[model samples]
Target: MNAEARNARWNVLGLLPAQLIMLATLIVPVGIIVLVSFSTRGPYGGFDYVFTTAPYRQILFNEGWTGELEFNPQYLIVVARTMILAAATTFICLLLSFPVAYFISLQKATAKMLLIYLVTLPFWVSMIVRVYSWIIILGNDGVIAKTLHALGLVDNMGSLLFTDTAMLIGLVYSYIPLMILPIFASIEKLDPALVEASHDLYGSRLTTLRRVILPLCRPGMMAGSILVFVPCLGAVLEPILLGGGKTMMMGNLIQLQFGAARNWPLGAAISIVLMAAVLVFLVWRGLRAIRRERAEAAA
Candidate 1:
């Protein structure tokens, strides 16, 4: 065979193992969940062999004993809340990450490496431990409260934990690195001469950022937004720990269904729905990437 053909064959061979692993780990489990979503709930827990649409119906509507369907908003509200929180987290992460990423990108190689390491230092700790640390820091008697009380900012150690604000703070803190890394990747590749040219033309820093840097970093921003938003949509630990079990997100609801509620079918259905939403987002991103590539090629 020719050199190109032999290389192509080798590439396919190299990918075969990964393909099999993905099929086994991801595709198979998702297929099982999709199948279970259509099945009937058993007497105690788990699911029965009988196929039914009751789970989906229950998510969207309430059925009376007489079989009259009424619109239900409970699950929809949970989904909406999840989406809102995820979006908010993504926005906050974007705002916080941009400056940090730009600063890192502008640093010398050694300094950049150290800054990157610091940015990712939290990952060295266990996620659960990091989250628990937030609990201590944000607790009423924790550092913030103590500092505030010492300064006489408040009459008491006011509650900061177990609130939506606390949950948002945790989400932003946890996901900010995900946002920063991508933007830094993009900014590091940017041509410094372009910034010099803009400045030579007497462009202000804010103007250059708006017209030059942001446009160039759009891909990284989009990637970071998706990375932050998708997982935030399915966040469980932050809501449970920080919100004090009062905030119910989609992930928390799914956990409850599978654990406490003992409704495997419903849980599977919710999982399927969440997966579908993520798939939709992925497809949208893929299409946008393709179009952008085409536009760049055309230009």
Candidate 2:
């Protein structure tokens, strides 16, 4: 056989193991979930192997006392809250990350390395540990409350731990690194000459930033936003510990179905629905990216 053909065969052989692993680990589990989502729940809270769409229907309507399907907005509210919080987390992360990334990108080599290391230092500890630290900081006798009392800002120590603000803080802290790294990589690729030219053209710093830097950084920002947003949609730990279980999100709802609710089909259905929503979003973004590339090519 020719050398090129021989090399191609070897490359395909090398990829076989990874392909099989993905099939076994990823695809098989997802296939099982999909099948389970369509099956009815057993009398005792497991798969019944009976075909039905009741689980999917249960998302929007619950069975009423008269055995009729009635419109229910409880699950819908959880879905909305999940979307809102995820969007807010993405926006906050973007805002916080861009400045840190830009600062890191502009630093001297050794300083830049140190700053990047600091940015990622939180990852060295377990996430649960990090989250627990926040619980201490936001608790009634925690740092913020104690400091406020010392400053005479409040008459007494009041807790910040069980609020939406605390949850947002935790989410942002958890995912901000994901946002920063991508934007920093993009900023590193930027040419200093471009900014210098903008300045030479009598452009104010703000004007130059808005016109030149932001456009160039768009790709990284989008990627970072996606990284933060998608995971936030399914975040469980922050909402539970930080929000004190007062707030319910899609992830928490899914956990309820599988755990206390004992409805495997419903949980599987919610999982499928969430996956479908993410898939749709990805497809939309892919199409928009393709269109932008074509337009740029034409330009």
List candidate 1 stretches off by more than 4 Å.
64-68
What candidate 2 gets wrong by more than 4 Å, as runs, is 1-11, 65-67
Give the top-scoring candidate (lDDT): 2
lDDT of 1 by residue, 1-299 (tens): 99999999999999999999999999999999988999999877889889999988878988766888988788989999999999999999999999999998888999999999999999999888989998999998888998888999887866899999999999999989999999999998889899989999999999999998899999899999999999998899999889898958999999988888888989999989998998898999899899999999999
Put down candidate 2 lDDT per residue, 227-265, tens digits, no spaces: 999999999999999999897999999999888899999
Model 1 clash pairs? none
Our tally of clashes for model 1 stands at: 0
lDDT of 2: 0.93
Model 2 scores a TM of: 0.95
lDDT of each: 0.92, 0.93
Position 215, candidate 1: lDDT? 95
